[model samples]
Target: MSIKIQDLPNRAAFDVKSAQDLRTQFAKDPQQGLKAAAQQFETMFLQMVMKSMRDSVPQDGLLNSEQSRFYTGLLDQQMAQNLATSGKGVGFARLIEQQLGRTVTSPGELSAPAEAANTAGNALPLSTSDGRHLQYRTVLNNLPTSASYGAPAAAPAASNGDVPATSKDFVNRVWPHAVEASRSTGIPPQFLVAHSALESGWGKNELRRADGSSSHNLFGIKAGKNWSGQTVEATTTEYVDGKPQQVVERFRAYASYEEGFRDYANLLRGNSRYSDVIGSQDGTEFARRLQQAGYATDPMYADKLSRIINGPTLRQALIG
Candidate 1:
């Protein structure tokens, strides 16, 4: 019996068995199979866009309830699938099909496109509960390929001398300052260091002044009305409704790294909102409290910070 795209039932968003069946059909008949796979990808992409749009808008109307939201989500998913298969889709399916066709030459290359299709179908909508998965992927993607669970070689120091030559260098350079900040705040020094590393990308991505000097704002503490210090204007990423958007903002500039750490500690110590974060000994609790205290706008901030504190990258660097 010949397997036709129309013969297959419309698969659920995360149906692994259905994905496997699609790949099986692909092996038997590549042309129709490719079209089915592309449609599935387009459906998933459209659903994600719809979910993001829904999340951006407030849903606190009188008629809004969990039951209503659930049914609305179902409607969105069905609509996505229908639009994808209707031949008048957003053209994503056509684009994917065309690209895959051009790249896929041999039977061995089939698995690559098949996996791509399956990944799209298996994608989940962004939510607070799902932030850990996003955090893990972000950490993995950001990790240095040269060093996996080990100390990486030193990069050339920047001409400005603020950037560290390696992760080990970063730890050594900031350890004393972190310890000083830690003593005042009653937070662990490692936690402080990890937080700074997460903020600054281990000092390599520190904000710069107009003269290309380091802003020394490792904590990403923005300039507020009460602040009386040098400032730097730079574009920074802020997450709104779980989506990252870049905006230019003024940030506190420091004369030295130690001053930056000192100001960061003082900010937390002085602000009543950060009371829970001040004395946190556990890395996870510290990060969670910081996020709750409105330290950063990034939705995955806590998870990302906690991962850096507990992950092998920092540990390996510290030992090295």
Candidate 2:
């Protein structure tokens, strides 16, 4: 049940080449690569701890001889390796794994459908072999800062008028990414557009920062604890005790509408509570399940979304 130090192996001979290989591997397959790198980091960290402990001991005795010190360093390195391999060292690996795990998207995971892939004019780009040019990368790269607050949004579609000129315009704007999202979740693109329209008040009332710039949070998704991105605080209407109440809530801010749509799709697909809504062909059923799953504070959230799905917006958009 116990590990003997005498039986421990020598320190691993990790070098610059090994480090470069790990970085390359992490870029290719994150789960395996991150786990491997994390283990190595833990081993190094444990070695540092062991070295520190050895250094703190007095050097005035027979044990402080040059040969003894050399043997002690070797022993400490072996002890660190043993502790790391046995899962008894500090949990640096787990922490690194957790942080890096979110960035790993599977190959073809976010690919668009056949229909959307063929559609040209949309901002949502197909993932390349390198994946460095993913459309959503714009969101992470162009994060909102305080100075950028209240600045004009990049897209002018929402700023044209009270309501969009036509539902076709909104559909055209989000359709490609909607298809991409649908390919992942099996929810229809029309339904996703309808949901976004409802959440954004037909593109009239997107969440805005203090200076009145749009947050592009088409889903009205509130910022949660795990949200490490930029946010916008805005007054929102919520149903409390079956009565409407105004409250300022923090919502996730995105660099663009496409980014917001992508996040929305991921939110529903990633969450277990929204399991009933995912892959449901029936828009009505999806709406009802999303509401039932506590997607919105409004008790009539399903009804409102259902109306949007069945309304003239969708009707006209479908006809076009």
TM-score top scorer = 1
RMSD list, candidates in order? 17.3, 21.3
Relative to the unseen true structure, what is the C-alpha lDDT of residue 87 in candidate 1, on a scale of 0 to 100?
71
Reference-based lDDT, residue 103, model 1 = 35
Q: What's the CA error at residue 14 for candidate 1, in Å?
A: 47
Model 2 Cα lDDT, one tens digit per residue, 140-176: 2122111001001123254464345555566546655
lDDT of each: 0.66, 0.60
Tens digits of per-residue lDDT for model 1, 81-120: 7788777669987876776564343343434544554354
Models 1 onward score TM values of 0.51, 0.50
Q: Which stretches of candidate 1 lie over 4 Å from their true place?
A: 1-160
Off by over 4 Å in 2: 1-163
Count of clashing pairs, candidate 2: 0
